[model samples]
Target chain A: MTERDFLCLTPFLIIAIAPVMIMVVVSVLRNYKVVYGFSVLSLLAAFGSIFFVLPSIPHTIEPLLILDVYSMFFLGIIIISALLVTFLSYDYIKQLEGVREEYFIIIFTSTLGASLLAVANHFVIFFLGIETLSISLYILIAFQRSKSNSIEAGIKYLILASVSSAFLLFGMALIYTAIGSMQFGDIVAALTGHDPLSLLVRSGFGMMMVGVGFKLALVPFHMWTPDVYQGAPAPVSAFIATVSKGAVMAILIRFFFIIKGFNNHYLFIVVSGISILSMFLGNILALRQKNIKRLLGYSSIANMGYLIIILLTGSNKGIQASIFYLIAYFFTTIGAFGVIALLSTNEYEAEKIEDFKGLFWKRPFIALVFTLSLLSLAGIPVTAGFIAKFYVILEGMKAGLIVLIISMIINSVIGLYYYLRIITMLFSTPSEIKLPKLSITGNITIAIVGISILVLGIYPGWLIDLIIRFVSL
Target chain B: MNVFFYIAAVVAIISTIMAISGRNAIHSLLYLILSLLAISVIFYLLSAPFIAALEVIIYAGAIMVLFIFVTMMLNIGLERETEKKWLKPCMWIVPSLLAAVLLVNLILALKNVKSIQPDEEAILPKQVGISLFSTYLLGVEIAAILLMAGVIGAYHLGSQKKKVKHRFLEIN
Candidate 1:
């Protein structure tokens, strides 16, 4: 590889090295604060390294990776989200006894995996990235092994994820057999020659969609979402909900756009059906959920349902809308889960709706931040979620996806009801329970997320312009 | 070559079936090993001797031995009587039938494709290694990372703690 190739790979290389460095530090020093500081510094350095490669916009490292503006954009989101999760995890994980430092090491590895997904240009890298991310998550979810719930979620995710990975590998094998290539560019070149997809390719793509759907928590493949979210620590749940799903979403967009999967009638119909089902079922199920984390899980399914509508739009505007939507979602989700993480102590998880009873009376600041997050999720005005949803709906209409647009709108309203219910509970008569003392790191993370949401909601022009300038299929 | 291929394929299929359906874990594992060997024979017959050797040495030899050890260490077969009572024909029949249906469909699909005869020349191990290290080097690195994560996670989760109380209470 040339120096330029190495330059394009700086972010991934940095992230990859961080975990090993942390492992070394752990073996020697075994200080939680030191490891945590090193992790944050490494992430910051990785984020900064993106600019060093900015002058070299589009660079493909053979069959494996492509470092481009689009991937960089996603890398930015993934790295920053991972950093925020690390911040939120500080107090949450510190409260756990023993082996706390390894948490940062796992976060570094998972972030590396997520970053790899953003730059992946081959099936091999795609599969490896996903496995790295999922395996780390399995450990992270079950990190609090004393809790049977955590262990249950980890095992559940492991089995389901492995099954989905099998389907994906089989699909990849089938597709390779059919097209005689695994590279995205080569597959599309081969596909353009065949006007219609063959049975084998169709089946392969169908099975591949199952794996993607499972990652995105789309309908029918969404059974694990609520359980896993509820079972995992709040910060880890935030990591899974945002960074993991966003990385997959980034790869899916790239893959679909390259393959032109949206143009095929059957593929389009199938995706539309999945999205619609996800929106309705996700919202409907969330309506009765007392567990706030599970409620957010279902809401996320609905949010993803909304997000995929842009995929069917089959336009550059659609891609921008999707990225914008993900940014909004990253902030909203982390903010919401950060609140849970803040309220939760080592002794108890503050996940149930009743746990937040009269939270506004007790701690008005946290309640307000939670309110902002929930409102944004519900697509209420003056929150990032509203503008994100509106952008998506507008793009969907531009592509004349009326059916999907209608479903999203209806689902948003249904989503509003549950969000409002929680908001109401937050404001109701005070419950007699002492809240955990807020840490400086957690509070700073929440403030950054809250401000970004408002900024994106109110003044999204700059980010949109940045996306338009750099991001291209 | 064709006859040998067919014989190995049939053995692989039969052993795979036995592996899944066998009541005892050790028996099932032994059947699985047999199936893997049959597959390796087919691979060798198809002229990919390197992959066939790797399959036997890595999968059948190393991984299967680990499985056996783990199963033996768990002493899972001590409850064979209880498992046999629970493993009614009804429990196995539906899945077996479904799998058979899938197998039939797969066979039909394969029948539609023209089969290409394997070349007489075998793929050398040196060339395989060259390509794997050169073209797929990034994949190999990623896989290493994946394995490291898996090992660390497994080690972390598998290690037993002295305090086996409520996870909540165990936390500070």
Candidate 2:
């Protein structure tokens, strides 16, 4: 590797070292505040290091990774989301009984995994990055062992994720057998010579989609979404919803564009079918949902379905719209889940709809933040989701994907119903139960997320300009 | 070499079946080890000595030992009656038949695919080590981090401790 490669790898290197440093500090000090402080600082340093290497990017670290503007942007997103999750995790982990310090370690490692996925160019890095991310998640999901639900979710995720990973590996093996190379560029080069995809390559791509679909929780593989989301701690659920999905989406976008997979009408139709079904099925399932986390989980499925329409557009504008939507969705999701995490008391989680009964009466500030988040998710006029959906629909129209755009529009309407249902529940007669006091970090994190949603919603031109300038294939 | 391959393949098939059908966890594990060893022998017959050795050392020796230790520590006594009830002929028969059909399909698919010519020279362990360190160094580092995450997760989850009350509330 050249000096330029290491220079461009600054963010990855810093994140990789941060966990070891945290481990050392934990062994010596055993202080929660110290550990949390270190984690936040490390993530901040990692985020800053992206800019430090910005001038050196558009460089590939041969055979494994590529460092470019696109990846750097995503690494920024992943690190920032990890930072938000860590901030939210503080109070939630403090409420747990024992071994809370180790939580930050897993978070750091998982963030590293997610960042790796953003720049991965080979099958090896793709598999390793995903494994690292999921393995860390298995522990994070089940961190609160006192709750059987947590353990059940962890086991379910572990088994299903492993099965999906096996399918992915088999698919990679099949592709490698056909092309004698596992690099995306090589596969594309080999494929351009053939008019139609070979049986092996086609089957391999299908199996690989199964794994990706499971991770993204697209239709047919989305059964685990609500269960896992509801079972996991709210902060972990937020992490899964944003960082995990976003990173995979980043890689998928890169791979698809590289392979020009959209040209194959069969694959295009398959993706279109999946997206439309996901939109309808996801929103339809959440219509009468009581659990807030599961409702958001279903909302996430529909959101991803909307996002996938951009893939069909096969234009830079589509990619920009997807990134903008992801940014909006990230803040909205983190803010919403952060509220849930804050409201959760010592023993019981505030997951059920009834838990938020008359929340507006008791804590108007918290309730307002939660309301803004829900409004953003529902794509109300002033929230970030509106502009995101508008941009995506505009791009879809330009690309002539009327079917997907229509489904997305209908799903948004269906989505607004459930989000409104929760908003109404928040405003209803106040329940007599007392809520937990919010922490400083949690409050700050939610405030940031909430403000970003409004700012992005209102003045989205700057971010759009930034995306057009920096984010390119 | 072909005769040896057939012998090892049969041994592997029988041991795999025995492993799955066995009620006692330890016995099942031992049968699995045997199956792995037979597969390694088949690998050796295919002239992949390095992979053969790795199969015996890693799968049969190291990993099987870990599995055995965990099983022994857990002390999962044989529930033969439940196993018998659950493993009814009808339950196993259908899936087994389906899997057999899949095997046939796989064989047919392989027959259509033109096989690449195998290298005449055997791949040495040194070559594997060199390539892993030099060309695949980043992958190695990533794998190390992955294993570190796994180890930390395992340690944190496995350690037994008393559930302390919420710290802020405890002092109050």
Candidate 3:
């Protein structure tokens, strides 16, 4: 490998070393604060290294990874989201029953997996990266092993995720056998030539989508989403919602952008069908939910529906909008869940909607922050979610996906009722329960997420312009 | 040669079925080991001595032993009272059907594709090493990372927690 290759690969090395650094810090000093600080420091350094290669990229480490604008952008998001999760999880994990220090190691390892997902060029690396992410999450989700729900969530995710990954592997082997190639570029070339992957390739693609769909928690593959969401710790749930789903979506876009045109006719139809089903079922099912985490779970499914529809548009505008929306999604979802993390303690998780009652009266600042986040999620005006959804609609309209645009609007509207219900619950008359005080790190995390959401929402043109310039479409 | 290959394949498949269908976990593990041994023999016949040895050492030796110990620790087999419930005919039907479908699909897929015959001269260990390290280096790194994750996960999950004293006790 050339010096240029090494330089381009520095960002991955930075993230990969974080788990080891954290282990060292934990060994030397058992303090959670120190370990957390080191973890955040490593992530920030990794995010910063992206700028080093940004100007010169689309550099490929042949057959394994690609370094480019699209990858760097997602890597930045993954690092930032992971940083935010680290801060938000501080207070919650500090009070967790079992060993708390090793949790950061798992988080960092998952971040490593996620960043790999952002750039993986080979199926083997893709599978390894995904499994690394999944294995780390299995432990993190069940870190609070005293709680039966946490353990159950971990086990459920383990079984279902393993099963899905097996499907993915089977598909990968089939594709590898059919096309005699393991690289995404080779597959794309074969696909673009004419008839791509015979019947076997077709089946392989179909199976791979099932695995990807499961990771994204789209409809039919969504049975594990709510249970895992409600059962795991709040910050862990946020990690799943944002990092895991975001990384997978980035890879999905990268893979699909190559196989574009009418060549992916069956794929487009199937993904569009899943998106529509996810939107309708996701919103409709969340209507009566009292549990806040489960509510977000279903809403996340609907959000996936919206995010995925952008990819099907098959244009640069579609990629740009999806990236912009994913950035907005990370900010808003992490903010909402951070608030939940702050309010919860070891005794109870504060999952039910009633737990949020009279929040404004008891803790007005926290309540307001949560309300803003929920408004963004519901696609209300003046939030990043609105701008994100607006761009999605624009792209959908450009593609003349009139039915999908209308359905998305309807689902977002349906989604608003539940988000507002929680908002109303927050503003209700003061209840007897005392709202937990927020820790400084928690406050910092929410503040960063909150301000970004507001800034991105109001002046989205800046990001949109930046995205149009740098999105590598 | 063909007769021996058929015998080994049939034995592997049957033992696998017996492994899964057994009422006792220990018996299942023993059957599983037998299946692995047969699979290793098939691999040897295929002329991949390295992989054949790996199959025996890793799969038959380590993995089965791990499974057996875990089953014994969990104390989950040979309960006579639960035997009647466990042996219900309904339990076997679905799995048998799924297995049937999978086996048939495998046969059809195999029939469709041209299978590569093993080389007369076995692939050298050094050649395998050079190809793996040079061409598939990223995969090696990722595998290391995956193993590290598994280690961390296992350590975190298996470590015992120390119980904290209550505030009331501290006050006393």
Candidate 4:
């Protein structure tokens, strides 16, 4: 390895160091507030590191990972989401006992793992990064050990994740048997000559897709999503829905982009089918959901479907669009979950739709932020989701996936009903019960995210140009 | 050499079955260790000696020891075993089907295996070590961190009583 390789991988090294350093610091100090402050500072430093290496494009960390525009962009998203979640977690985890410090450790470790996923170019790093993320997530989900639902969610995630890992490993074994190497570039090179329909390689790819699909919560493999989301602490849910999914999706895009020309029509069709199901089923089922977290869970599956439309396109524009959408979705989803986390107290999680009734009267600013986030998620005009959906549709049109584009439009319309329902509840008569006051940190997080959403919606040209430039470069 | 492979494979399958099906946690853990050892031998046969060694040391020796310790600590002794209606059948059926399919595929795939054309420079251990230390050094270090995290996690979870005692003393 050269000095250049080390330099390229510096961001990852920095992220890895932050959590361990914080962990060691916590051991000595053992102050919750100090630990939390350190966690936020470390995450902010890690976030800053992304931009430091952004200007230098297309650098490979040879044989294992790469630092490039795609990676930097995703790292930007991951770090931003992590920072937001960490800020939100400050108030959210304060209500809990004995585990607040450890929560920061897990959060940082998981963020480090997710960032690794964004840059991984080899299966081993990919697997390691994903497992790190998963193991941390399992613990995070069940961090409230006294809550049976939380423990159940952890067990469910573990079982499903272990099964998916097995499938992924078996797929890797088959792919290695077929192509003799696990590196992305080498696999692409081998695939260019071989028939895409070769049983070994096809099945391997199929199984690998299943594994990724489970992580991304694309339909058929998404059964654990709602239960896990509802059961997990709200901030952790936000992290999973945004940063974790974003990192995995970024890696999937990189992998698929290399093998773009491989005409795996069957896989394409399967992906398309899943996308259609996820869009329609997710939106329709979310309509009946009373639990807010589960509703977001369903909506997330639908959003995943929308993102997959770009993958189906197989163009540079498609990749650009997906990246842009991911940024938009990350902000909106994390911001929305931040609001939920803010409202939650020690005994109650504020999960039911009724719990949010008349929130606008009590907390207009938070209500407005939540409304804007919901509007964006619903693809209303002048929100980030609108621009994201428009870009995706345009990319789909470019790929001539008119059917998928139509399905996305239809699903977005259906999706608006539930998102708007939440908005309407905010305006209902104030409940007699006193509502929680928003923390300064929570308000700042929501405001920042809300402003970004509006800004991205109104002027997406710069972001689109950035995405295109990065994807092409 | 092929005969040895067959025997090793059989032992691995049997041990894996025993690991999952054994009622006693310790017995299952022991079988698990045996299966891991067999897998290491298979890895050795496949010329991945480093991985084989790591498998034995890290997985069979360390992780399994931790697992057994946890089992003991949890005090899941030989108690009244609830009848899992599907588990017994699943234990017999799933492994058999998986093994049969894998064995058949292996045989079929081996039929088309081209004769070995060894590269003169293909020194597996040296190459792997060099690549690991050079190109994949970050991954290796990360793995070490991961193992450290696991150890720390185990200790944190396992030493609850001690932590409580320490806190009590501090409070007093």
lDDT of 1 by residue, A1-473 (tens): 78988888888889998898888878898998899899999999999999998998798999889888999999999999999999999999999976888788888888878889999999989999999999999999999988999999999999999999999898998999999989988899989967678999999999999999999999999999999999999999999999999999999999999888888988999999999999999999999999999999999999999999988988899999999999999999999999999999999999999999999999898889999999999999899999999999999999999999998888888888999999999999998988888988888899999999899999989998998887988
TM-score of each: 0.92, 0.90, 0.90, 0.88
| Candidate 3 segments whose C-alpha is farther than 4 A from its true place | B1-17, B34-49, B72-122, B163-172
Docking quality tier of candidate 2? medium
What are the per-residue Cα lDDT tens digits for candidate 4 across A175-265?
9998899899899888885654589988998899888999999988999999999999999999999988998998888887788732578
What is the C-alpha DockQ of each candidate?
0.62, 0.68, 0.59, 0.27
Tens digits of per-residue lDDT for model 2 on B1-172?
A: 4444565677678778978998867667867887787777666555567998999899989999999888766644755654575467754553355335434533443353333214445668999999999989999999999999999999988988864787677765
True contacts kept of 4: 0.12
Highest lDDT: which candidate?
1
Model 4 per-residue lDDT at B40: 72
Quick one: best DockQ, which candidate?
Answer: 2
Model 2, which residues run further than 4 Å from truth?
B1-31, B38-47, B72-119, B162-172
- Predicted chain A of model 2: TM-score relative to the true chain A? 0.99
When 3 and 4 are scored with lDDT, the better candidate is 3
Top TM-score model = 1
DockQ of 2: 0.68
Docking class of 1: medium
